[model samples]
Target: MMSQYKSVFKDETKLDINYVPYKLPHRDRELRLLTEFFSFILHAPGKMAQRIVIAGDVGSGKTVLSQRFGMNATREAEKRGINLHYVHVNCREYRGSLFLILYHAVSVFHPSFPKRGYSAEELLQILLQVLDEQDAYVILTLDEFESLIEREGTEAVYKLTRLQETRVNKPQRLSLICVMRNLKILEKLDASTRSTLQSNVIHLEKYSKRQLVDILSDRVSLAFKPLTVPEDTVSLIADIASSEGGNARFGIELLWRAGKYADADDLNVVTPECVRKAASSIYAVMRKSEAAYLSLHEKLFLLGIARFFKESERAYASLAEAEQAYAVVCEEFNVKPRSHTQLWKYLRTLSAVGFVKTEVSENIGSRGRSTIIYLPRISAHELEKELTALLEKDV
Candidate 1:
């Protein structure tokens, strides 16, 4: 039976389930995006690398997709003798203020951002001068860029865009590729500022089971040697990812753990059972690692929601009631309590991380409308257990 199974694939015994990434699935859409942005820079003396935003939910392949675009564009430009320089930064980590980011932005061109030590305006001026001197365009792909507006406000971003219009011998030929988590945040910008930049946008949806299945199958082709993966095993990963709201990233992650699970068991083939066991074993453990980072108060708040859910048998609770439960949880944990607004902030972060789901309720209560929140991707009981395991101290 095993020998027969081995004959099914072109070769057998090797299969990689990790997300090494490929263009096979999104080739047309991806190139369409690349060329559209490249079109502005490929011809124009100024603005060859156009400003564009690619935004999507977490784990929806935003980072991977943008990385591919940057790499592919660089290679294509090199082949065609188009001078191009590309760099990527996750704006969330570098959030200090606008000038700080601008200072760091210089390093994207060279390691000497501090060596430039120029004011924000001077830094940008020098960068524009560098682009002109090199006769090449710089494409900066900033991921999680929305965090910048939240942390440093819109003015810093607006200032960066303004550099494009600065004229030296010619128009400041700077191209910006900003990756945002939420495109709706664009409304927060002034109409003029929004119009000059954000000329194009690409929105990515969470992966569906079918798309994830294809993604995993392709990844296996590249990462592993041959046909170690069973068909049902691959399908099982699809089901887990679909239940988790179609995150291709999660699908690849689960598959990677599944392979490890099989190897640990000394199994020859990765079976459906091995993959299913991996869901609760390896995947759940990593989930705990994330849960570990939450502040104690945040954990207690989440625990309150979970306890409420477990006891009430309802997926959601009003803020007033949740607040009461949160207080009780805080008392039990012997931790300082946070205000309702603080808890709400934590909830928003948790929801963004896929542990919770939130929806706006129009006029559901006295305060116009509040967000109705629930733990969709995770269960309250499991969340409580996971949080309990991660914390060495109380709460």
Candidate 2:
């Protein structure tokens, strides 16, 4: 069986979620605009850095472009003998508290900083003091920033934007780069903060089908050996991504998945069928962050649904059976199950997020009387593992 597998991936890590390609295709305009806007930080030290907002839809290249700007800014700062740093933090992971976000930002420079027992103000002061003492310039980027604003309110944004006013003896200069899905979150902030960010905003549009194809082609060259991923397969993945809102992340993920499918069949080249199979689970894997945020009972409920489908002969499972299965799972895991009404709410939540599909039974006799539930995009086994990992980690 080991010999039966023939892999096509040259470097699998190239397709990883954290991987940023050396060359970002179809994103030059955005990168160039950011560089021009942020030139002040590179040229002058101690000058008030610009607070720029990067707005875009999911997988629209905002994160990568901001990272590229950071890389170039670092290099340019070094050449000019400027003490500058760029720290990127995802707000979703630290959205629960403003202090946690500040701790993450400050810890980038001071690795010895304690993880707990510091107030939000204290963290900000520590960060300000360190940067002022070093005479340094820092650009702190918050990705998925809307999550932070929504969870912790705009106090964090207010303080950061008004950093110059809050400083005492030595003025501390800190810039902020906020990468969000859209400007809707800005409305939640105070009028003053909103006006400050309204000055510099870069919007990234979703990629067209052709643009996605170009972007995937670049990644394919880096991720797979030549000819391993055929042009037709790439086109198929592009079409899939385009249909799913031109999300380049989804496009590349499909490419990687298709490659794995081909390898599992001992094939040297990825095909359209492999692409389709890969897409079947894209939503599940892509929503890992959302899964991680689910409550314990909710995760168990999802796992129960997955197991029901995996064990049953049919592609779908009734809510009645799923609720019973969930009760069994809760017993095995030593968790008390929630009420049936609560479980239904969880089902609705999952369906809202595209994790599962809930529809009335279409059978002749039972039609419109009962609802059937099924995993819409991801496989049962894959979801089980994902939920298991999330549950085990919280333990």
Best by TM-score: 2
Clashes of each: 2, 0
In terms of lDDT, model 2 sits at 0.81
lDDT of 1 by residue, 66-123 (tens): 7777777777778778777777777777774455665565666677545534566677
Query: How accurate locally, in lDDT, is each candidate?
Result: 0.67, 0.81
TM-scores for every predicted model: 0.64, 0.70
Model 1 TM-score (2 dp): 0.64
- Distance from true location, Cα of 156 in model 1, Å: 1.2
Model 2: residues >4 Å from true position, as ranges? 1-5, 168-172, 283-395
Which 10 consecutive residues of model 1 have the lowest summed lDDT? 5-14
Q: Put down candidate 2 lDDT per residue, 210-235, tens digits, no spaces.
A: 89999999888888988988776786
Error of 1 at 155 (Å): 1.1
